[model samples]
Target chain A: MAVHHKILGVATLLYLLVFFIHVLYFSLKKERVLAVAWMIIYATICVHTLGIVLRWIESYRMGVGHVPLANFYESLIFFAWSVTFILVVMRKKISYPVITMCASLASLFLMGYASISPSVEKNIQPLIPALQSNWLHVHVVTCFIAYAAFVISFICGSLYFVEWKGVIPPKAVLEDINYRSVIVGFYMLSAGILTGAVWAHYAWGSYWSWDPKETWSLITWIIYALFLHARMVRGWREKRIALISIIGFISVVFTYFGVNFILSGLHSYAT
Target chain B: MTLCTLRRLLSFVKEKKTIRLPDEDRLSRMDFHSYVPGKGLGETVGILTKHYRLAVNGEQGAVLERGKLSRYGVFIIHTSIIVILAGSFTGLLFGYRGFVTLKVGETKDRLTLRGKTAAEIPLGFALTCKDFRVNFYPTGEPKDYVSTVEIIENGKVVLGKEIRVNDPLSYKGIRFYQSNYGSAPVFFFNVGGEKIILTEREVFRKNDLLMMVARFEGKVHDFGPGVLVAYLDNGEPKAAWFLKSVDRLREQKLQGVKVSLVDIQEQPYTGLEVSRDPGVFIVWAGFALMLLGLYVNFFLQHRRIYLLRVSEGLLVAGMASRNREDFKKEFEKLTEEINGRTS
Candidate 1:
């Protein structure tokens, strides 16, 4: 198997273990072991990154000569890598082990899709004429980074909601952390769209084409826009805004992977 | 004697009716009516009615406004829509998109059209592909396609550049792009009663009255390509309309001219897209403004912290903002830093 495949397998197994441990910890109320679980998640993420870089090198050997973001398998791996990377960054300010589970779960889902999904082919392919550009690296990496950040905020937002409505128990610290994560995510998302627009204009003749990918991206941006408006203009409570953030992140997921797999248009290259 | 005869001939040719008359008056009046105000007003009104509006206001007064009316959240949405429309229109009206496919030595006069139809035509000058090359991966997937092209005007090459997918060539308000690739049939021509057997190495001029002959090169022994002939007659040109496979010549006669399609060659060519946009700078500026707006909206949270001195050393501080938790945390951190610095 390829290095990427090995890393993916490892990441998947680790993520599943982490998920099981999270459930067991939550049920058994073993909060102290949560830190150890987070460390395990972080280590798996590092391994995933190493695997991606190695895969990139492997593509160069195969003469593809582009980043590992050309197709569904590579993109899924990238998505997992980005989500984990962002989660690690947020951990410093958040100081909570619970959110690590979200990253682990997302990684697990990506690995599962890569492993079992017949539609997703795990082989290095050639770059199309349209994708044969240096912008491929800059455009794709930045967008996924921003997406990862959004995923983090979304996870935190779910926690905020559960706590806010007394469904899980209100924790002010957790809610505040979730709100901050969303703010960071929104900023990165804005940057990602801008970068993508610039890349589109450079690659294609137009900046925005109302293609399904572009439309859904705008839709994702709009959801976040509404989240911002609710936070700033409407003076929304953190709990409600967090719930909206979760909803917004779900839309982001749909926009990133769902748009590629389910919907077809200019972004079909991603699929 | 020569002068007198010349003067007589000039005088006879000069007539008042031929110089100016009733017909000229009517034609001038028609031109004037075409430019009259009433005719254009209806068109202007039609355009005015198509404009949309967006507005936003609190109970007291308007906060944001644009277009026809004001509504909350309309500012961002409408601006975004306008931005999108403006970008799209700029792309459609001024944006040029076409592809150029050239074999190893073959050159093309025009790029192939892509995207919307109306946006594909070249606004000014013609682009000719001088060269095209494709680098392939070991697994048979294409790595890159590069096209070398020149902008020609009045039979002279004005500019020359090589363009790739990300790195497009732009000169004098036009851009050339390396877009796609495919295998095109190369043909040989025989003209002027001489067998001019040219392979993939010869370059042919457009609308030239030249006979052609083509053949298959590789050992694949497959059915080959066809030959096309374009001829110029009395300052007007006509193209031969027929497709002949390899080893098969189609003979046709047009306007008493004998034409035959010889052979066809299959050669790989690169496709290039061309475009020209005058409003691209404005669109880029709009993107910058949008990014600025988002940055300000996200990073800069409006918070005011006021401090009032009580008696002696006691002081009370208050904050008026929506993000009370963030404000409180920042306030505490600031006060701690200040105390540490003062102490």
Candidate 2:
């Protein structure tokens, strides 16, 4: 019932609207409908950003006084925001409404899960001693950006093989976007892992402890690394490269959610 | 030899070698030996290579052009992985991690190593825990665990700091992190005419009655501060609370023995994780090199164009390490520029 939650709820509804409008744009082939969807997305993002900032202010009011990147619910919100933000930024380069709809659906799912999940704690809580550091902001921001890039790439890569019958862009365009997003994701993931290591060293006196979360992150990194090597060095294309991109996103998902939910480790705090 | 065979064989000869035939023709007949471009090349190619920061090499019969950025990027990235592994390996070999628990006002110069076999190592300097304080939120979740510690060397107080989670104390290349904390409760007991003292986790035995001070509780059912005492009866452990604020339980009789609580005090002990990793900086260096290498590899392209003398004027073939489609367009534009300049 807080202001920020209401704002986010409104944003979520707008996102659903955006998805429907995208569908309309595709079915009717109306550029006006597509333009309307873009306009709604921009407003949705603004409201979404306001909600995030307001939640940060709410945490301060609650005396926690930390960034909103502390818990599972907050992370989901940030993930949704990052996905939409990245999609909009890359809108000019990738003007495919179908991709936008895929992204919108992804963000809706994240926001919906954050709001509807019974396990997620929505209240602002004080950080544990270990997470009370500046590195949390750096590490979480970079990792989510990387995840957003991968999400976009997953959309493009999946559409490449679908039999859309002229509804989708050329395979070359999708492939290029996939490749570019993977490159961005790879670099951000590397930075995220590095920052995590540095923060761990400061807090626990060990940089690399084969914790499940850390191991899964390394696995994700390796998968992406393989993707890059196969595409860039081995000159793989089309289905093979698309398959690797999808697989890499799967690893990313496992690292982000599976490790937090199923495995017990130092990152159990995330759960 | 064919281009693929030559490329595979040349992989062993040069670290940064690229050979591809975008469109193969009689131009492939030109005998080509891949040179590690930066190492050996013609002065003309070398000058252009340095000026453009591109990779250009002179083979036996043709001149090959490629962006040196990708080559060096691959080289740097691969080498950085080796460097990181080596750094961590060095840490594993040379570094030591140990733990020490210091009660307030206690000093220790040795720590027990963390591994299968417990071994103690000298810390070179003694560290004393001045105080251990833990702050908690109203929700009872701990917000901070801080230990005020001081380092002493040969009767001199050298360094002092308050170490907390994510904020550690470093002295002589060894870091001390505030890893954990526990309460060290002290209890004084008077049984009949004998007086005894016990602290947290300490066992006291007299006449087959085994007692241990388990922990100190702030409020036990609103009876005020008390100590939880565990007693072994018939080899089964049973715990009972002894309240300092209550007169009846303060001097309770157990097993025909008069056991009276005299006074109790609770102090906190700080648990510090100690480590000295000399290779951490090397690992950081590897991280820096890797970021640099990745930037080049992702954002830059490696283009290799081969020129051969032909019956009409000249023959040109081109390829790229990655982004082949984009390179096709670039190659076309470049060849047009070449023809325009010559015409």
Candidate 3:
């Protein structure tokens, strides 16, 4: 209980590190060990999922009985879980280990940063008055899923530019995947924003207070909307659309983490 | 094709919005994909009227169209957004939020509007705080603070209910939420046959013998709440630890004193937030509609088909929604089905 987060954090990293090894082993050479890698990916996902559930159980045992998604430390673990989940689900359809590597790398960084950060509170704190709602689960889960989706699209878009056909997927496939992931991310993040607004209205008597978190979420939403619109335009080429995808994911990252660290609002508990 | 199938298809077409299609026996050509310059008038009209609506169109000429959702889906999403915006604006224009603080046994009819400057507004009906209580968890964190309130209209008790943090009481047009609570220690004493309640540090003079509750102990010796009373005679004060609810005057009080325990009360003041928003229901409706619309827009894929009446045969062209390639395979299958049936 004293270091439940520490254990989960290390578990996430170990999962990421092991998955990354498979990604490296398969991507460079023409060896189709995807079955082995596929099984390994699910195994890592199970371990990562176990870690998250353990954290949740620990919070409940701590008498908080709330989801372990109230702060930055917990959200980072969730972010890693989401990314790995997406990776495993996507692996069956897209024949690319590079995407897994990219996703795992991002998860690795998030989990590592969360585990090493001295500022983030790792303890299972009781839910504050404003945070005691079912909406906490809905908003945080949906938001992290959106973030996870965007992270996948960001990897696809980045690889579309850096290495078009050698190890990563081709330009057309990556572009298609990027657009599709953005579509999913857009819907999820929109749901998250609406649920957060409703929760805010219930707790604080106002729905949209233009708080830093709200503003940044709106910004991220607008950017993705623009990306979708640009995708429809005949003039916007593949590279331009890919660039927008990356930009949108960057904005998503900022909205997820930067707002908590840099701005103060009713959502300050997320810090 | 069989006569029964032809009749069913024809009947279906007749029930739909009628439009003249290029004749199946058109002059020299029947194509599904190639477009002629419309040496005839029907071809021009068919091409010109393609954009009238958002639904599939199939004709006797074997032209099957789809992707109606492709265009209308975006419109639904956009219109739902407008609806949500309208609902929000309605809330902003008509909604009012305010709060009132009520102590036990106090009645209030006015609320202070929540803003930078406090403005008192009448609630048109009186609200009485019958009682307020706080429950704490084993960890010392507050579990709940509940207020039992009564709504009085024309001196008649119309409604009475307990309101907690997440649960609110609604009457007529407004809602009252138990937002907060606070307690203040007070000492109850009988002095010279006249009972008086003195708050902490408050002094009351009875028969020129000044008496005051100088301090309070929330708990003393685990026997429950006790207070220190200061009695002054010519500026020379006598202090005693008095449990206002217990008969402790003889045990810890000054000898020959007439003062005795009446009761010690921790008067609880409940903070109630009053809100009335006519647009909340509309806003929720809009949210539901938007969610439904987004689901339709994303989950439903549309496909369209074009048929060209050419000299060689019927040439067919296909289109998929969102420019996704996976739909092209579906379109190919549809085209193959039409070819197998018509040819």
Ranking by lDDT: 2, 3, 1
lDDT, model 1, position B297: 46
**Model 2 residue B181 lDDT?**
87
Ten contiguous residues with the weakest lDDT in model 2 chain A: A87-96
TM-score of model 2's chain A? 0.98
lDDT of 2 by residue, A186-256 (tens): 99889889898989999889989999988988999999898887876698999998998899889889988
Q: Compose the digit string of candidate 1's lDDT tens values, residues A1-271.
A: 8877787788778889888877777767776667667778777877787788888888888766568898888888888888777777766666555677666787789878888898888888878877766667767777788777777777777776453232243466666666676666666666677677777777776666688877887788888878866865698866787778888888888887778868888788777
Please state the Cα-based DockQ of model 2 relative to the true two-chain complex.
Answer: 0.76
Model 1 in CAPRI terms: which quality? acceptable
Whole-model lDDT per candidate: 0.61, 0.82, 0.72
Superior by DockQ: candidate 2 or candidate 3 = 2
Candidate number with greatest TM-score:
2
After superposition, the stretches of candidate 1 with alpha carbons farther than 4 Å from their true spots are A61-65, A92-97, A156-178, A238-243, B1-123, B153-155, B183-258, B265-270, B303-310, B314-323, B337-343
Which digits, one per residue and each the tens of the lDDT, describe model 1 over residues B157-215? 88887777777777776666666777755654444333443544344433434333223
The parts of candidate 3 lying over 4 Å away from their true place are A1-10, A26-28, A58-63, A92-95, A163-165, A233-235, B1-59, B63-67, B183-266, B306-317, B335-343
Poorest 10 consecutive residues by lDDT, candidate 1 chain B: B61-70
What is the C-alpha lDDT profile of model 3 across A26-85, one tens digit per residue?
665646565556666677677777777887888788677778887778888899888887
Per-model chain A TM: 0.89, 0.98, 0.92
